[model samples]
Target: MSDALLSLENIRTDIAQYHILKGVSFSVPRGQVTMLLGRNGVGKTTSLRTIMGLWQAKEGTLTFDGADITGAPISARARAGIGFVPEDMGIFGDLSVEENMVLAATNGMPDPARLEWLFSAFPALRTFWKSQAGALSGGQKQMLSIARAMIEDRKLYLIDEPTKGLAPAIISTMVGALRTLKQQGATVLMVEQNFSVAKALGDQAVVMDDGVVVWTGAMAELAESSALQERLMGLSMEAH
Candidate 1:
């Protein structure tokens, strides 16, 4: 993709003696959401970790906004306009919600307008501003994790399964928040197991199987074809 904000070319990652990503390749187009879909243990999480430099790629190139960052440290990548929301949510349970957001801001303080916008999107963050993060519900904690990443504007966001294990209502809230991000022209590459959420927000889709990319195309195309979804992901879209 000519307008790709991030591109991974033949990325390979290994954990000890185990190979996780076997030459994975994909591009995330700027100002759009790209869905990284695959079943459990197919290296989807490892791919996101490699892009964030949490797990170094043994081979291949990582280009962000036309600059090669394959060897860059995690901090350097974060400084160079990349935000990551891991599968664990990476929240500081001991801290207050307000404190967490403050810590996520690069300047030590979030912009008042941006904070207000986030509060509007996730009202629970505002309600629990001074409350301990550990006291929040699972869904609220997930909202805090995503809100922290969105506290500072970045060129791209790598998010892992924002709606996993949530109730339908909570998932709807998450979907709305992500739609707001898209409206603001944020570029995101997300790994989501929920087919409904993927179809709702993804502009492009990249499917992985056994540590390698098996398919890449428009999300709508994949959504419209149950056969393609079944072939790539081992289940039809309706199964979700």
Candidate 2:
């Protein structure tokens, strides 16, 4: 974690009586996109939730920007420049897209330049500015969720399965938006099952199984080795 912007060491978490994370450890490098890839129920989402303070770590430490944030509140972590996009795409369905964005702004006002850039990245957001978020399509809602998180500048983003169940066309849009995010030098920790999207955006990859890291390497390496992909994720990238 020498140059890491975020580091997690021996993190342990429990949901009810079930131990979800078993001493998970990883480092997210500054200005790079790190992919967390694994089969379902492997603690990938749990790790992100713990990092965002949604679930308290029963043991171990979480550090962000050289400060220990293991015990910090979710709001404090957000204030420290940590942004989260949950697997469910947490959004205010009843609110207008514009209103949702406004609410996500830290100071009650978004930077015009950033808003402009986001709109360009996901044009449907600007297209449905006054519409209710619930009325939008699946891909549009995903765009809104990610756009809302970008309403303010963030140092690190924890995004879970942004392209979970979308059409190929919409996935392409998501890939474009993520490319824009990478170009802006955003530090991202994303949980993705889509191998194509992970390959396109990931600088590094972490493969997990049964709540522990099984492999850590470059995304290119994972992309190139079908045997490794099958061993870790239980499916080859070609099937993805």
In terms of lDDT, which candidate is strongest? 1
Candidate 2 off by > 4 Å: none
For residues 55-74, could you state the per-residue lDDT of candidate 1 as single tens digits?
A: 99999999999999999999
lDDT scores of the candidates, listed in order = 0.94, 0.92
Model 1 per-residue lDDT at 181: 95
lDDT of 2 by residue, 1-240 (tens): 227999999999999999999999999999999999998999999999999999999999999999999999999999999999998999999999999999999988889999998888898998999999999998899989998888887999999999999999989988998888889899999999888899999999999889889999899999999998888888787688
Best by TM-score: 1
Judged by whole-model lDDT over C-alpha atoms, candidate 2 comes out at 0.92
Where does candidate 2 clash, by residue pair? none
lDDT of 1: 0.94
lDDT of 1 at 166: 89
Instruction: Tell me how many residue pairs clash in candidate 1.
Output: 0
Report model 2's TM-score to 2 decimal places: 0.97
Error of 2 at 69 (Å): 0.3
